[model samples]
Target: MRLEGKVALISGGAHGVEGEMMGFGGASARLFVQEGAKVVLGDIAVEDGEKTASQLRDAGYDALFVKLDVTNEQDWENAVRTAVTNFGRLDIMVNNAGTGGPGNVEETTEDIWDGQMDVHAKGVFLGTKHAIPEMRKVGGGSIINISSIYGLVGSVGSTAYHAAKGAIRIFSKSAAVQYASENIRVNSVHPGFITTPLTREGLKNPEREQFMLDRIPMGRIGDPDEIAKGIVYLASDESSYMTGSELVIDGGMTAQ
Candidate 1:
């Protein structure tokens, strides 16, 4: 029960995408629930979000589902309000909703670029903006921004995606510095190519999968649970002194 009595609101926390199951949000949601946090699963995917909350409830955890459009300020406000109304306070905020970017600078359209910024950059900003007050009400809290290894290192394609993630990475540090004295810890988690619906299409090609695997010194990608564990640590008192830190769980990809 590392997160016992904590209230968490996770963006893009629906349990499934297309036919694949669970991304970083869903995985972290489960871990939060297991560790005794009352969770609000926030996502635009209403059905799946409810399903996930229902499953957690069935397993005897305190959970709720909220319809959240991360790109919308009103939606973020509602989600935060709902979590506080029901759970009394918010302790953890996970900005884990995002899409994979596969386009280059020239190939990327304005819409594509805007979408990435809105969802990744703007979404995170909104989440942190709204979540801070609720966290302060509880005396202090933690915010986990989901970034990517691509955010740390420049890559070949997906210029917009990289840009948005890079935005999140730095944004987290800024928030951490701003709120450290208030006991509000803000940190970013950078995952290398994790197995999730977002990467399903790319991994479909065995060649591409192998090419990615070859680059990782560990000879494999990551799992959502692995990243979730790090989140749990940040959200818990175990990392009480840590703030403005970047947790990189990329199977040794970045070390090289």
Candidate 2:
């Protein structure tokens, strides 16, 4: 019951693009509820998002689903309003929505690059911008921005994604520095080689699985639950003195 009396708003909270594979947002929502919080799950996938919220409710958790296009400020305003209106206050905000920019610089279009920036960088900016007022009203809060291991290092075939994710790293730090006095802690989480909707198709082959494993010291991909645990720690009072930190849960990929 780490979050026994709290409320959280998660962007991209549906299970996945197809609603089957659990993404970080969805997994975190489940864990937050299990630890006693009322969660509001937001996503662009209407059917799948609603289904996730319904399942949580059926399982006896307090949850709500809202259609959210993270790029839209109006959509973000509505989502935050929904959380405060239904759950009473917003204690946590998880900006976890992202698009996989799947091409190299020479092959990627301006439109493709902008699309990734909209969700990964701009979206996080807007989420932090709006969630702050409500959170301050309650005295303090926690904001979690989901970055990728790519954010911390250079990678191939996704230059645009790397740019946007790296932007989040600095953005989170700046926000943390500005809000530390208010008790509002802002931190970033970097996940590596996790099995989510985006990576499931790519990891189907045994050879591909082995290829990814060879890079990780743990010799395996990560589970969504493992990352969720990290988010819970950052969101709860357990990490009361922490702020502006980057929690890297990459199985030692960045150690090298």
Candidate 3:
């Protein structure tokens, strides 16, 4: 009940390593709903998004699904409009829609690089740009931007993804500082090597799994629920005093 009486909007609610049941956004949305919050689920995957919303609604929770491609400005506007029109206010904005593309400096293509930036970096910018006004109207709210350990440090074969995530980290900080007086708190959550649908293949290989585990002090991968709990903390009044901060949930990988 951490988010009781709150309203949340989660992008990328339909996909990821968690699949439909376990995706970070999906879990966060469901958790918020279960905690007595109305949630608006947005994603490009219309079928899955609608299904998630329908399931939540059937469970007697307040939920809505909007077809949203985070990279599109008009789509962002429409999604925000749906939230306000349906729920009357927006209390939380989770900019969780993102893409991770493969590439090292030499292996990366211009198209791949641009795609990564547009989805991860620019999408966050657009989500915040549109959500802020509604949040301001409601007095105050929280903005949670999903980043990666790659944002804090680089890895092999992650050139484009790293750059885009790094940009998100700084962008969230700057936004948080600029909007603190307005009562809108902005923060980034950097997750390290979680086992999600997007990352299932890499984790399936025993050798690769061990390699990743060895890098983490915890010696294991993280669960989507763990990350969702962090999001809940940031989205609720429990984190009222926090802003312009990077919450690292990396399983001690970055501690090294």
Candidate 4:
């Protein structure tokens, strides 16, 4: 009941580390719904997104699915419109849609770099821009930007991904400072290597998985639910005094 009576919009909810049972966005959305929050689940994967929404609806939770290409401004507008029209207001905006960009600087192409930037950095910019006015009307709200542990440190073979995530970290902080007076709290959540479809290929190789685990002080990859819990905290009033901050849920990866 942490988010009781709130309204949430979660992007990239179709699938990821949380699995069919629990994608990060999907898990967070479900958690919010269970806590009495109406959720707008958005993603480029229309089929999966719709399914997730239907499941929530079947459970008697208020939920809706919207096909969202985060890079498109019109998509953002339509998403906000749908949420406002259906739910009356938007209380939380989670910019969770992102991609793992090309892994090495030398191997990265211009297209890869641009695509990563468009989805991660530019997408967050657009989501916040459109969500802010609506949040203002409600007097205040929360914005959770999903970043990565790579944002805080250099990762081999993930130049563009690291750069985009790093940008989101600072961008969220700046937005938080600028909007604090308006009662809008902005924060970034940085997660370490989590067991998701995106990282499954690497995880399949025991050596690679062990390499990742060895770096984490906790000796494990984080669970999507763990990250979802952090998202809920930021989305709810529990984080009222927190803004312009980065919450790292990396299993102590960044600590080492």
Candidate 5:
């Protein structure tokens, strides 16, 4: 019961595809509920989101699903409002929704760049903006932004993705400092080669899978559950004194 009595809102909280592995937000939501927190799941994947929530409720966990397009401000507002109205308070916010940007500088179109920025950078900003006031009302809260290892280190491709994720890294630090006095803590998580729906399509190529496996020092792709454990730590009081930090869970991919 590390998160006992707390309430959390997780964007991108739907399980990816019916039979596929879960995403970070979906995995995190389940962990939070197991730790005794009521969770409000927000995602645009309505069917998967509702099914996830229904499963949790059947298991006797407090969970709800709200349609959320992270790129939309109104969606963020509604998601946050639902958490508060339904659960009474919001204690943790996880900006974990994401889209892939695959292209080199010349190959990257203006639309691709803008779309990447809207989803990764703008989405986190909006989630933080709305979450702050409510967190303030409850004395303090934790905000965990999902950044990529690409945010910290450069890659041969994914130009727009790197740019957008880098924005999230610095944005998290700025938000952390700005709200530290209010008892609100903001941190970013950097993941590498996780086997989620977002990366599954790419990993289907044998060469691409080997490329990732070779790079990771541990020689294996990480699971969403592994990252979720780190998120649970941040959401709980276990990390009360930590903020403005990067919790990298990449099997030492960036260490090299």
Candidate 6:
């Protein structure tokens, strides 16, 4: 019960459905509830989000679903309100919503760049912005922004993705410095090639899967549950003195 009595709002929580593949948010929601926290799953995928929340409820956990477009301020407001209204208060905010940006600089267009920024950069900004006030109400809270290994290290492609995720990394540091006095901890999580719905399609190609495996020092892809455990540590009091740090769980991909 590391997160006992706490409440969390996770964007992109509908990345998977019941009895199907799961993403970081969905896995985090399950682990959080199991650790004794009430959870609110927020996403643009209404059906998947509702099914996930319902699945949790059926399993006897406290959970809810909200229609949230992370790029929209009104939606952020509504999601935050839903958390406070239903669960009483918000203690954690996981900015986990994202879209893939696969082109290089020359191939990347205005739309791709802007879209990447809107979801990865702007979305994290709004989530942190709104979560701060609510966190202030509770004396303090944890804000976990989901970044990528691409954020820390550059790749051959994904120019816009690297830019957006890099922004999140520095943005988290700035937020941590600004809010440290208030006890509101802000941090970022960077994941490697993981087995999620988003990556499954890409990894289906034998060569692509081999390419990823070859890069990882662990010689294997990561599981959502592994990343979820890290999130749990950050959300719980176990990391009480930690803030403005980057928790990288990439099977040692970045260490090289």
Top TM-score hit: 6
**What is candidate 2's local distance difference test score?**
0.92
Query: For residues 108-172, could you state the per-residue lDDT of candidate 2 as single tens digits?
Result: 89998999999999999999999999999999999999999999998668889999999999999
- Give the per-residue Cα lDDT of candidate 5 at 17: 31
**After aligning candidate 5 to the native by TM-score, how far in Å is the CA of 161 from where it should be?**
0.7
In model 2, the runs with Cα more than 4 Å from the true position are: 16-19, 205-207
- Give me the overall lDDT of model 4: 0.89
* Cα lDDT of model 3 by residue, 1-256, tens digit: 8888888889998752223436789888877887789999999888888888988888898999999999999999999999999999998999998767997899999999999999999999999999999999989999999999999998888899999999999999999999999999999999998877678878889998998988999888999889999999999999999999999999999999
Model 1 lDDT on a 0 to 1 scale: 0.90
* Backbone clashes in model 5, listed as residue pairs: none
What tens digits encode model 4's per-residue C-alpha lDDT throughout 70-110? 99999999999999999999999999998888668889999
In terms of lDDT, the best-performing candidate is 6
* Candidates in descending lDDT order: 6, 5, 2, 3, 1, 4
**Worst-scoring 10-residue span by lDDT in model 6:** 12-21
Can you tell me which runs of candidate 4 are displaced by over 4 Å?
Answer: 16-21
**What lDDT is reached at residue 130 by model 4?**
92
Q: What TM-score would each prediction reach against the true structure?
A: 0.97, 0.96, 0.97, 0.97, 0.98, 0.99
For all candidates in order, the CA lDDT equals 0.90, 0.92, 0.90, 0.89, 0.94, 0.95
Runs off by more than 4 Å, candidate 1: 16-20
- Supply the global lDDT for candidate 3: 0.90
Off by over 4 Å in 3: 16-21
- How many clashes show up per model? 0, 0, 3, 3, 0, 0
Error of 2 at 154 (Å): 0.8
Better model by lDDT, 4 or 5? 5
Q: How well does candidate 6 score on lDDT at residue 117?
A: 99
lDDT of 6 by residue, 154-176 (tens): 98899999999999999999999
